[model samples]
Target: MSDHPILFLPGPTEVDAELREIMARPLIGHRSAGFVDDVQQVCQRLKWLYQTSQHAVFESAPATALMEAAFRNLVRPGGRTLHLVCGAFSERWSKIATDCGRKPELLTVPWGMAHDAASLRQKLASSPTFEAVCITHNETSTGVIEPLQELAAVVRDASPSTLILADVVTSLAGAPLNFDAFGLDLAFAGTQKCLALPPGIATYALSHRALERARSIEGRGYLLDFVRAVPETEAGKTLATPCVPLLWALRAQLDRIATEGLARRFARHIAMQHETLAFMHQWQIEPFVADSAARSPTISCLKASGRDVRQLAENATKAGYKIDQGYGDLKGKTFRIGHMGDHTVARLQKMLAALLR
Candidate 1:
């Protein structure tokens, strides 16, 4: 048995044995011809998953780094940014914008609730034009998935030129996202979540319009510069040395994803969500996101239903599983079960049974 508890957390999900073995291979220099070819191939394959024509770039950082990159590259210093906040991660984006010296205008909804397109339409009609509107496709903290396609349309109708930047950290591989079809200027995700890889790497793709916006903007620092990185990525290169091992693991996993079929993968996630929901029902617990349509298929936040969620988490730990007690203010009142990544219904059922036991 492995020493570390199996991860059932929202991120840094279990890297399967195949990927682990792939990572064990000797590392290659990021600048090598072979590595460049691998990057190019992986980027092309990634387009299949993103369902977009735009090529994706791999960065040796967490998804939050790319969140900051979106601001620095797309928005001018202190530019007006409209943040749609419904949960912790969305709120974090607003805080990051503030930390970057931008006075972000937030359209907040209750936690565990989703931002509706109608409210966004009203807000955009009344407010001044924003440089960009930040949106979280899936709120990992609350297990709420925003209606991004609808919101994107509302943005185009109300504020045509305003860039739509999305954080798909928990939705990328497991959810259906058509970047080009939805008219998203930029969409990004970390590998740890639904991609099922270990933490420390992120991938992102942006539209040509966003690239033009980045070129027009200044103060778009060195490391995360979209103008510098996008072109290089198109040519199978990166601005800096990437996490080579993770890149290898990503390539293997992308291949696995292709073999499994993207539609099949999505169906698998939905099945897992149903299985988890059924288990929660049996326990007489309810999901924190009351509206089923708004709930994330990747992570399920269930109310503790008067149970000690902290102790429940500890019990899972003792049983050689790692589970979330819940996040922030909801700590004892709710608990989370991450059903994304490489996890399947059967495996999740086993874990659910173990937790209940």
Candidate 2:
């Protein structure tokens, strides 16, 4: 590897050695038999990652597109949608719903605070029946991971008919998420984050309820229609030209994850978070998210009360170590360290040593 600072940002984390080789492989036509075969294998691996027995649509577009797709499919024009927001990415899905003409309401908490199940239950009780409830499993901006499983239960008990949609962009393989067991109607993720691959393709899954709801919607655009996409995806081919190179890379990366074992990988992320927290304690750097249990194992955010967060991040980048300043409204108020996607405790120690200096 070159002397370039290793990436410690939330996404595009790192490409493993095997994936590098696989991405260099000769290209294949999107509709060719060879491409279909590759995708079939990738989808199988993706289903395992998604923790769903049902097939998933691995779209060529970014994760944001899938957000709109979910809105178009589940919430018909002018239908009510509830968006639970705690950070930038979660808020974006709400915007997507708004643009799609699906009336979306935000059930929001402060940046560092995690949304609790009791609050959600109260909201569901007071609000009119909604077509869908959108949630972000891990708030990448604030480095907070919502208690998704518990929230799902709350949604089911409150409103069984409402579809539960989640964005697991940063939590997919890095955490212990069970889609089927969680009873989530729909969930999606991009390969760029914890999956440790370059940006391009995105993955999404739908439960029986979600699929039925999607079919009932009308006039969804060709590309954004989940009802139209299922047939093509079931055959391991996208609705249009797919990203062949990224698909190949995803296949290789899935093998890497499988070899490491999901449980071990999740433990590795938690252990690395613990290591970072230990360093924070020694440095007297406070965490932005006060609740220890609410913090994300994939990313750690530090308050910047006594430090120049941007300067520190810039210095690290100049010194060949990549880190991130806070995102959106929290910019300059906090700094983030991404501990997901192949970042080991030893690697983090070295990166932290460079930054702490």
Candidate 3:
């Protein structure tokens, strides 16, 4: 086994050695013709990975930037948006919408519970003014996985005008997200999570409708405006200079993911999640997300129960395995274990053994 300590924490999770090497490649000019070709290839691969033929842009910032971009570009001033709030990140989406001067109605559930599609349907039915709906496909804070397809269907049936914007920061690469098939207006994820790449870059896919929305709106922020990004993306470049090293790392990681194949990769994640949940059961600990259906396959949020989760995490870290101590409102009450990003079954078993010991 490698002597290096492994990362089981969500986001900035374990970076594969090959990907690390890719990032170490000498930096290239962001605007060079060769670099443009590189960026175009990366974008194409991203679209393939996202299961969408639509445009996929690589952002220099993390997923948060893309979140803000969604609001600024898609939701016009005075436009109404329905934010499905179930955890810290989901709430942040709502906050971003409001910050963009849009009136956003929040469909909230407790941190540990999944947001219900039926409730969202009712909300949309009653509120005809909503122009878009924002949802987190996987909530990292509470380890809850919202039913994206069901929720998308609900929104489509209730409000055809409502564009569906999804955050898949934690779910992408670990699970299957058919962006085109689901008809999502926009979706984005960071490279640090399931992509097993280093931080500093995010990948997002945009539908034709999303582009139209952006074109209709004026004075959207220059950096994140889809109208600006789309043309530059078609030209095989970015609006501004990008983190070239991170882009190389992303390409490497996507290549690895492709080699593994999506079906096998998703199944591997599911198996690891099940293994972690089984261990949690043995310890008499419950998952933060109570409904198994709502639990994320990439990361498992385990309730700390009577134990000090912080201390437990500290102890685990000292043993060379790092884990997450939850986030936001459930910080102390829960802990998260990431099973994504090149983490193998043997590695997970070893970590579980160390924790149980």
- Cα RMSD, each candidate: 1.2, 1.3, 1.3
What's the ranking of the predictions by lDDT, best on top?
1, 2, 3
Q: Worst lDDT window (10 residues) for model 2? A: 1-10
TM-scores for all candidates: the values are 0.97, 0.97, 0.97
Residue 249 accuracy (lDDT) in model 3: 78
The local distance difference test score of model 3 is 0.87
Q: In order, how many clashes per candidate?
A: 0, 1, 0
Which has the greatest lDDT? 1
lDDT of 1 at 258: 89
Q: Residue 310's C-alpha lDDT in candidate 3?
A: 82
Q: List ranges where model 2 is wrong by over 4 Å.
A: none
Question: Which parts of model 1 are misplaced by more than 4 Å?
Answer: 1-3
Compose the digit string of candidate 1's lDDT tens values, residues 1-357.
357788889887887988988888987788999999888887887777788886577678999999899999899898999999998999999999988877799999999999999999999999999999999999999999999999999998899999999999999999899999999999999999999998888889888889898998888889889888877876888888888888888989999998898899989998988998988899898999999999898999999997889888887888788889888888888999888888888778778887886
